[model samples]
Target: MKKSAAYWIWTICLAPLIFLAVVWQKLPGRVPMHYNINGEADRYGSKNELLVLIGILFAVNIGTYLLLSNIHRIDPKKKYTAENLPVMKRFAFIITFFMTALSCFIIHTTLHAGSGFNGKFVVALIGLMIAALGNYMYNIKPNYFAGFRLPWTLESEENWKYTHRLAGRIWFVGGLVLTVLAFFLSEKAGFNVLMIITAIIVVVPTVYSYRFYKQNLNK
Candidate 1:
């Protein structure tokens, strides 16, 4: 593994260990998140088992990063930077971090330990992370494989360029704010903020870009 990737891999491994170790014993036996979209509860083990599973997720994340890094190394010509992916690979790790925490929350509730959960609130947290992920993906590439992939964006390179230029800044800043808030806001209020922010990010650029492209096309 390249030194950079190796460092991140190790960093991921230790992230949960350091953050949750102190509170590992304090984790509620059952964490009840009201919204069960998939109806899948992560209630399959003792607290000890749950901690092990978290470790496994951490390990898997590092391994995946390693593999991708190797791919980059093999094809040194291939660069995974903001221009190519708009900082997507880097943002992906952040998304994964939030997702892991969300999953742990689910497990914490399902195990039926202590503390009542605010379902809407927890759902909002997940939504914020998801919105951030979507924003990053859109910024990463104008290609269909990455971002919003609107008809205009896909149809015209110019449109793609313009849309991403605007989208990148919007999403990056929006995501940063949301991520920070994720640390501070209560579940319900936090999610409400995330939902509103997500809608604005999606709707504004899409409408603006389409109109902008049309005007240019006519001109």
Candidate 2:
């Protein structure tokens, strides 16, 4: 079953490259390769630039899938279980799906050139991805590769459990807000909110984990 899942995961990771190949001939000599905060195409480059970008994304996608798939083997703690395996694979597929969609979005943007990429749409996509991950974060077991994995959290299962629970809530709510802001705010404003919220989600958990560690020491 896991091998079948791996095959599907790799197929999804390769989808963007396949898509690019099909549309390669249709792309113009110069295409919009970069967009400004306002979502206007500001940099033009050869269609080969898109090819390079797709190649890089594909490499990253495959590398991430491999790492997640084998994370249990590499972890010294080896805290994974038969149940945890499916969850990890599902998360890997979610990430693969997001990257594939992102690559397709970029290709569509390049193909349409001046149609103007929707920055808000990308923002919302990221938000959705974060929210989806957060939804699973609570169930994540202690692995060296994923989650808060702080020194303090990894040392103590209690810290890992409580910190992840808190972080999961923070991320889910923050992600939802970011998604809503993408619809209502300017691109720049939406990005600003995303940065602030991302910091909050990361910092809050780190601080909480450390505090939990200190308090336990005092006890």
Candidate 3:
């Protein structure tokens, strides 16, 4: 039961949910549970539903942390090396932080109906997260549970490194562009554009990985 640094990080991330729970009775009875791309709350539910959402979020983050921390125990092919430990810890921190932000945003939007949470901002935050991940993707050692897990990449360490390096550049640039676009475009238009950019970000790397593998095979 010796907790790792990631456990501490997750605890910090969960703090806001605990705070919200303490103040739950004071919140409005009918709260906005879901919002559309236009920044309007299209769905409504009891404030108590927030508790369910928070519980699910907490479970997901903790479960992911445990699975990742003990990946070696589950996957025989993927053992955690000393060199990869820091990278894995950093990845866990990133996921926890992003979840924390999202949980807080949901709570805030519920508490303050006019809080102006919109798709553009959410997309921008996603962009920022993608960029951050891209920055570290190249540092990640080959693992079954993480990184660009295309068959080609997983099969060859060379393919994994090369694909990640290329993917890192694509995601960083794509993410930056998406973040900027989120500010200038209309909410609906921004969401459409975000989808396109995301598709490109995902598809390009996968195709490249396969091609790279094929090239190596031909050699």
Candidate 4:
């Protein structure tokens, strides 16, 4: 991993922890820790519990970073490791950043439990992350740990390339639509849209890959 990327990852991973430490005294003894699908706080717990949750999230971020950074070393295929290293590192940073931002968002919400859940913001953030992944999805080589990883995509390089190329465009557009809808629709409507789009993005690529494989087999 590049020194700069590693530095940012650490900084991001620790941001929520630092924030919680600073605001520990200000938080109420009981805080809302979970929200329902309708974006209402349905669970409450002690502030101490929030600390434990954040700590666990931070550890998960570190674990994820380490895994992504060394994924190529563990995979049997070594031919594309050097070429894909940068993409992997960039993705690591992106994941770290997203997780950090999400942690911080949760902390902020915890502090203002009365504000209700900001489903739109959460959905928008998720959409943005998906868009980012889609933007780089085309660059990902066939690997066990990432990308589509379907049997068809893994067995044929052509299938992998074409499937991802089509997937990238579909995901990018779908992500943007989700982001836009998050703000305009009610919480329930937005949730429904998110699910539908998620299904489309995942299923389309899988079905396309299978059909592409069959066509190639017939050829």
Candidate 5:
């Protein structure tokens, strides 16, 4: 059978569920359901809760795919173009894959109770995700659902392009730096650095967008 985007989406989404089913019998009756900033398990729940969590993940992945696949129907201002569909599909795939990986990590950690799921690792993963997104940020067409949808960017197509291009670079570089720091710095110190980088990536684009808008308005 020819593979398609939907086929990949479903396959990626279902892999975790299948893994969970295979390992369900091996899991303890009570498992770590949540963790703290210090990479310690702070909450516990019945193993059955994993089933619930998996169900939710499946729903979110499928729901998000369906919603994005039909985003043009919901957004009144913009219709899906041939150019945007592949970008959107790729975005959806990235999100689903990330979620699947996260869920599997959670399950693995829960199974091995003492094995700490490093908070810094999650930070690093998020950093990598942001960096991956940056690669496509410039290609994202103006839409209500994604990208840096600030008032100024939404109001002006030029503002959107300029801001996204700038934001993409910032996020890509900042994310790599954050990922490196996550490995070297103490968890507390790494978390602080991550926040600072996050602020820079977000605030810089927002300020630039406003300025871009104003400059255009005055012209």
Candidate 6:
């Protein structure tokens, strides 16, 4: 069959959502689409609220893709051809798609009770590891919006350079730790661990960026 040119690609990004949609139908109890049932069972929520949540997520994905796709200037000064751009874009699309799928998987698995030990979150966790591997394999240079973005990493050329190098190492280690956590930890513990990891990832680079900025100022 003729496919969606972007087929399987961007679609992969939404696989978790599709899984949820399907699982929602298949599961014994009725799971609301928008609002999560919270800490209660056999409970339903306002449809409006549920739609809003989905809307927000939809917006986030579209916005994130747009922001990531266009942020880097294609080294305009270098001679490049249009033919190569699509393939290059596809690579990026794949990376981003995987990131989204992974994220949603993690969210879905963590939030629901019967989702088995590792449901979608484990998939997301795996996707993230693959992403890290891809980043290393492609030697894909980091940009402001891609792969371990931090203000310190983007503030200045030097900061950006040092930050990504640091970030790459951080993400690699973090991904590894999280991957193990995904397998062994209880779901609650796993989510807590993920949040802690995310916090460290966000806070560390931000603090480092400020320090780097100050040092540069002094120099």
RMSD of each: 6.1, 1.6, 2.4, 1.2, 1.9, 6.2
Error of 4 at 182 (Å): 0.4
Q: State the lDDT of candidate 3 residue by residue for 117-147, as single tens digits.
A: 6677777888887887787888877777778
| Over 4 Å off, model 6 | 1-5, 13-29, 32-42, 45-63, 72-155
lDDT head-to-head 2 vs 4, winner: 4
Clashing pairs in 6: 34-50, 35-50, 102-124, 105-120, 105-121, 106-121, 153-160
Could you tell me every candidate's TM-score relative to the true structure?
0.57, 0.93, 0.89, 0.97, 0.92, 0.57
Off by over 4 Å in 4: none
The candidate with the higher TM-score, 3 or 6, is 3
| List of clashing residue pairs for candidate 5 | none
Error of model 4, residue 200, in angstroms: 0.7
Residue 97 shift from truth in candidate 1, angstroms: 2.7
Model 1 error, position 105 (Å): 4.9
lDDT of 5: 0.82
Off by over 4 Å in 3: 1-7, 78-80
Candidate 4 — number of clashing residue pairs?
Answer: 0
CA lDDT of each prediction against the hidden true structure: 0.60, 0.85, 0.79, 0.89, 0.82, 0.53
Tens-digit lDDT track of model 6 for 1-219: 226745755576566566556555444343333222232233445434443555466566666555545544543312223433443454456556656655465346434635433432553455365446434522334343344455555446577556656655666677677777666766666767777877776577667767888898899
RMSD of 2: 1.6
> Which stretches in model 1 have alpha-carbon errors above 4 Å?
1-7, 10-86, 104-113, 118-139, 176-186
Alpha carbon lDDT of residue 6, candidate 1? 52
Q: In model 4, what lDDT does residue 88 have? A: 81
- For model 5, how does the per-residue alpha-carbon lDDT over 1-219 read when each residue is reduced to its tens digit? 326755877888898888898899999998888877777888889988878998898899888877777776666556436667777777777777778887777777877888876777777887787778777788877788888888888777788889999988998899899888899987878889889998999899989888888888899
lDDT of 3: 0.79
- Candidate with better lDDT, 3 vs 5: 5
Candidate No. with top lDDT: 4
Q: What is the lDDT of residue 185 in candidate 2?
A: 93
